[model samples]
Target: MSRSKFFLVVLICSFVWAFVPGYLFQSLTSISWVCWVFSKSVTAQQLGSGMKGLGLGAFTLDWTAVSSFLFSPLISPLFATVNVFVGYVLFIYVVMPTAYWGMNLYNAKTFPIFSSHLFASNGSPYKIADIVNQQFRLDTEAYDKLGRINLSIFFAISYGFNFATIAATITHVGFFYGKEIYHRFRASQQEEPDVHTKLMRKYEDIPAWWFYSVTALSMIVSLILCTVLKDQVQLPWWGFLFACAMAFTFTLPVSIISATTNQTPGLNVITEYVMGLIMPGYPIANVCFKVYGYISMSQAISFLADFKLGHYMKIPPKSMFIVQFVGTVVAGTVNLIVGWWLLGSVENICQDQLLPPNSPWTCPNDRVFFDASVIWGLVGPNRIFGSNGNYIALNWFFLFGAAGPVIVYILHRIFPTHKWILLINIPVLTGATALMPPATTVNFNSWLLYGIIFNFFVFRYRKKWWQRYNYILSAGLDAGAAFMGVLLYFTLTMENRTINWWGTGGEHCPLASCPTAKGVDLGPDSVCPVF
Candidate 1:
């Protein structure tokens, strides 16, 4: 068959395959067969559950698990995928399990082996509202009585690495590309622009004032919202300005890594941390500041990518600017409409506990977002990462990340010809498991498995086939799966259509979340296993 024919065939197959895991046999999303084999053994399930536990011999059949987000195996290179796999194996399999079972760090034995959920010292859920007052600020008296908020071992360590990811981005970029950037900045002697840049000289370029006008108008509007609508927004105009400054500072380095390696370290962690310190007890303000600082930089990077595409395609700069501006407005409006439609159409949309069995409305990513608001905004860093906090040592990950690139640079110096030494991208390595919490073990496992198959095996052995079909394959599968998801949601799930079966519900590993610590009570009626 011709390549186009094969693409059509794969596209059809993708649509069909999505039904098996997405609807018919939902258990395929969490095929923890090991848990099924040892049905009654809590310990066994804890070791085998892909969604809630160690994920030994666990994998997902769902394509969304593998390709939905930025970590899509189709796009992220094999070497980068391997780095993520290494991070997952060591952290999830080795480090976290050992801490939970052996050292019992930070009451690790009192919480699930892997979860984003916050907990108390006694293995019970942390009631977030207990520490918040009527006006939604931190109630000091309530917090003092409640004591320090605690996170699962996974959540705690992940925050540490998050801090590291930011630090690593700066040092890694400087070590690898600092000299090149410095040379470019110097005005005396200059390297010629690339052919793409020179080719673009035919058309009149966009005036500098075009960009400045948009920026100034945006700042003015944002300032009005922050100050005039203070009651609803809760953010100070100064806080908004500071958030803009932070985005401006980090965009160059973050965008550099993103452009080259398809890796974009987030501004959320650092943004929220600084804002939490600056203005405590205001969750709305923190969330607002974070949205400004993180989203602005990422969106800016996206626009730059669009501009680069236009340049390479020989489109005029003025036309590119106009298209992007109008396109952005249209895209954003469409997104808002779709978001509202989904929110309104679905009942108990994100409330997992209240939803019926086998419901797929669980908003896992939103759960992570809410937990962040509680940790850094309502509770503030004073209770979570300062002297009053239990895990203050996590701040050291900053130093560790900053120092890592220095070591790699030294190793490259020692063996200049060893090309493999440079492949050790420290920034990518450290930020490998960045998707955990909202992402499961099966998600990483499935993504890595495909990354190896295509990027490593196919790219190396069948270069022609890969070059022709790889991206086409990605596009086909993504389009098919997305179409099926919307169709299923509207036709079946929204109308309260139901299905009942053993395999249709969640990963059957309830005990995986139960703390193994002796005498730790889950409720008035239940206590944790002694072993």
Candidate 2:
């Protein structure tokens, strides 16, 4: 395929990834009442049933077990917090930055980050090229081995540090240069007024205190009503109302910021912290947390930010949306297939029981266990340092990881004459990649490839591309996925429901359902039994 055509196809798929499954899932599961109420001609009941079934199947295979493992007290608190927080932060700051840095560094050192690779015929395979060309081929045996590698202390420590450092770095950047960055972007933009004018306007624009008081009081009442009538509720009357309120309250500021700023260092850091803290806690609630993490109302807020930025920058919203959508779909599709295949391979290896007892692959749950153990396990004599102190070394490592660019900048200064020296640090491109245990090597590799493609082709080449677009795309996919996830959670737990109204009137509501409601049946019940 031609480059543009290929790009277009990929972009379309990404949009589908952003909109399709997530919207379908949300429409059917959480807010099916919209279709039922507005589009009365359609059979909302049947659609809801079908969606519920699909959600159940997906949840059963993917999220349920992982969620349970996450929340289970059997998993140490420290481990849970570290892994979850790290994963959340990395997805935002580290993954994108590392990918962009690696790709750009590679381009700067060797080629242009934006130029088409199809024109070059080096025949020499780069790390990213090898993975992409191989179609991410790792046999079941290799996958299992990789899974084992993923579970190692090295992988845990490296990834943990990478995430923590990225979080700290982003936070620090916001603290130091946030206002400066905002002003710089604002200065560059042709339409925006100066900082003082903007600040005065913001003060004038904000609603009166009484307005906020009334809104807060209304929200409290709504929360109470939702809590009281949760089980008795039908479709999403309450949910829709709540969502609208949330969108109006939160999405507006995000949108306004996007419309005004070229860069939002302050908001970015705040977002990273919020995402980091909340994302980990999500899985503690249920598997749907993962889905929601990807596609909740936060996603809508992100989308508005992107949309406003695109609008202000004179970029076509349609084009930006399409590009983001295509990238997400491509990445998600590859991730799902590869994830499932590798998971199967790991399962097989575990069944054969070839690895050591605590190996990550053989013990899939070891990620949680190791994280928890490392932190909470350092009790008694280790209490001198405090529970947080055990992670001190790891934290330093993360700080170093976040300072990756600065380190490269220093190298550039030292070797001002020797340009190639900057390339040596390119191996940090594989920082997260190297941290993956053998079992999950395939999955991590796939993710890395996606990151590289995005950074090199999309971010680097499309210099004028609004950064908010990336966040919006991420949020949209996450929101869509999350809505479906919540629906699936209700289906998996809720029982004895009536269908007269949107099939949501049920006796056993998710809020009231016991943690052990689904029989506490982890896996086959006979093997790897849950207590």
Candidate 3:
């Protein structure tokens, strides 16, 4: 985003600022000042906690919290970013609080205001192991005795938004970009090569059959894994094909969004939901299907992004393909090896209940993943989102999602001169909250604040400075924060060292994860009373 003139200054400033929240003042990651003001009140903490609760009017100084899930706002177009802001305000401020407090949707007050954990009918933690038999299927007898699993209102509704996001992405792309894409395709096929195309064609080109052969080989192995190794994978051969088909279908539309907006809609939730609905009681099956369908499409978008960069740089297609292929192989292999080592080496990893407070190995990400498996695979969507599920009506979000783009397209037609009308992107808007479980509300608040400062104000008033240093600032901040993470891992995490001070102690919002329902006992000291 900038030039060499002020590059060093930008880098230094970015590093200096990132260092504050990255290490020294950790609680800056989520400063729910309202909670601090009303420090002893559970209700206040529940309403204001950025990490575990509603995060009402909360803010953060941490760039990691800002950039981790949302990516560099400097890179996103202002229109798309504005749409996200609108969606976030509507969902978080209006819809979420109303669903939880006013309507008491899904008995929301019975559990924490915002959490990812599953719960029993009486507000105890849902014991997944108790309801699972040796075959990894839900033991109907145990489930009946224990009663239906429940989720926090936020988790349940976030899923409904997931369905809406996926549907909206498809319909949005069709309404907005379908015609331009069709015409471009037609023109590319019919017209003679441009000078740049002719020049590019002179370079050594990768043969089409090479791609075909690799694809065919991958398919053969995948099919074999699903069929002959069905006992291991649990997903049937037909399910594997269906997953592939869905990925293929979604690849084009999702890529268009990614290529243009630098934001890609997640297919994991939708894929998992579908597999869970059709092929219930198979957790492994659901996960594999998600990995194939969601990851495959994601990789495709990544490849296209690389190709776009290569084209802009005039890199030969053959060279780009070879480099990408080798990089993929090495990266995949190393990731597996590192993951294997961590799972074996780490003690009581992901076991938050057993782990000491502030344990580095308490994996928030894995907690979300495990919860997904329980919802879509173990318990199945039938008992969660289907006829038997509490969220059956939330399925209407799919229709609401589809209709969103149509309404926008109509407005675009009527107010043709109002160019801003066309920029009301439904997909980007709806997907604004898609990363919430793993990405808390402070993330968005911090992100949006920075976005407005840089993308809007700086771009408008300090155009030249923004054009030169915006992206550079982002890169420097990310790199500095990442280096600090690695350093902390080696210096402190390796020896389980912690600086026990008020500032170092995380956001002081303990009651945020507690259930508010009356008569729910959470051990000896923690119990909810009638309000």
Candidate 4:
């Protein structure tokens, strides 16, 4: 097949896939829910609280599903078939028992609920306390009640839109690359290869199927567990599952890049660009809040895996690993501490008003998949400059931000400059910030700061630093944070008996002076004697 013709077909498919799912499905769902249901004060509160509840309930169940499914599917087809035939059997007999065991283990290792020391626990536990207190507060109880009513409706909207966006991004990228390769071959006067032929010849070395399958299965398990166990569990199971799913999903690119390119800076650049384009409307800080496990560890893993692969191909594993570990630890820790400080302060000070309404930290507002339509609806078509305007601000910023890279590319083309342009990413990012609405200026600035730090320290230091050391450092930091998160989870969620220091004058205690008869012999300590 001729390369040019192939590229043309690929381009066409990319264009269609990108627009169809994102616009038709995600946009539609977001508009309908955000505008009609979520925007209403009563409905919004109900929806918000419900989502929080659902997210918590599903946390554990999803983790079990994700962990088990990944290994199960990777085994033989017989195992996969058994998953279908004995699926219910496994759920009832195997999964349930495991979950029960896990719960018991958790209880034994954790503190009792309602304990004063537990209540006084700060950080994540305090955060959970705040959430619960806020939900049941006299002022917000109405919203809490309403949130329950509209919970399922909003979940469907938000999750559906999220899936739609993922679908669009993947399909668009696939088609775009496919066609680009096809066109290049056609331009060289080669015959157009069939899909199968192209797959075998060009992408056979890419491990594309492995990447796609892992990602798809991870998402499927997450959805199933979230839906089935959302209301059944006391623990925050959904959050756990979400974290695991994100970890695996984020690992896909790292694995691919590791196996293909030996820790190339170009891969990081490509990833950053793709992330910028696809994740624009959402707050970038979410990378820390929701998917920190993936974001921090995956990059380190990519470096390690790539180094290991290179080692197997005759590179020095021990030396490379050390370099990677040190670099990652130094940089990732700084990033985490800095990010926590900045975002935590912002969260405290700004509260709901931070970033525009739909920014990442603002829960109900940041839930873009389900709420986009409503936000856009409120903004309407004409009042694009209004503080609440959605599409206009996003569209303008995206257009300009996207163009910054292109402009850089053009300069490189004309001047044939050296690697100095790499330094321009910082300034270019600053320029992008300038394009955002005044309301979101802080958010953009935060992101710009992160990008600059990431590029300068992490990306650029790869060659100078040892790969293994970096991975170890990143892994250690993540491990520490995860441990703290678990501790906080137990301190906040577990039910415990509370002892009142002051005795009450009742049957359980003793009325007034009657309790003074301590010298009298009681028949049994368990049973108080009648005086």
Candidate topping TM-score? 3
Point out the worst 10-residue segment of candidate 3 by lDDT: 1-10
* Candidate 2 stretches greater than 4 Å from native: 1-155, 171-182, 185-301, 308-392, 402-406, 409-439, 446-531
Off by over 4 Å in 1: 1-4, 187-191, 201-204, 314-320, 337-347, 524-531
TM-score (C-alpha) between model 4 and the true structure: 0.27
CA-lDDT, candidates in order: 0.83, 0.34, 0.84, 0.31
TM-score of each: 0.94, 0.31, 0.95, 0.27
Off by over 4 Å in 3: 1-9, 12-19, 192-199, 525-531
Error of 4 at 149 (Å): 24
In model 1, what are the clashing residue pairs, if there are any?
Answer: none
| lDDT, ranked from best to worst | 3, 1, 2, 4
Task: Note the clash tally of each candidate.
Answer: 0, 27, 1, 48
For candidate 3, the per-residue lDDT at 527 reads 39
For candidate 2, the lDDT comes to 0.34
Instruction: Report the C-alpha lDDT of model 2 over 1-531, residue by residue, as the tens digit.
Output: 444454445445544543322222222223233233423222222122111100111111112122222211111222222333344345424542353334422122121111111111121111222212132222334322322111112233434544443343343344334687688778776766755455444332423564467556756765665466543321123443534443444343333332332211112112222333332211111222212222334455565667556655656545666665577679889989966886776544443124532222444434332232222221111221223222233434545545664665666687789865433321123232222332222223223233344545566677455243544443343444455446543664234232333232321112111111123332342221122
**RMSD, model 4, all Cα superposed?**
25.5
Instruction: Give the root-mean-square deviation of each candidate in angstroms.
Output: 2.3, 21.7, 2.0, 25.5
Model 1 alpha-carbon miss at residue 474, Å = 1.0
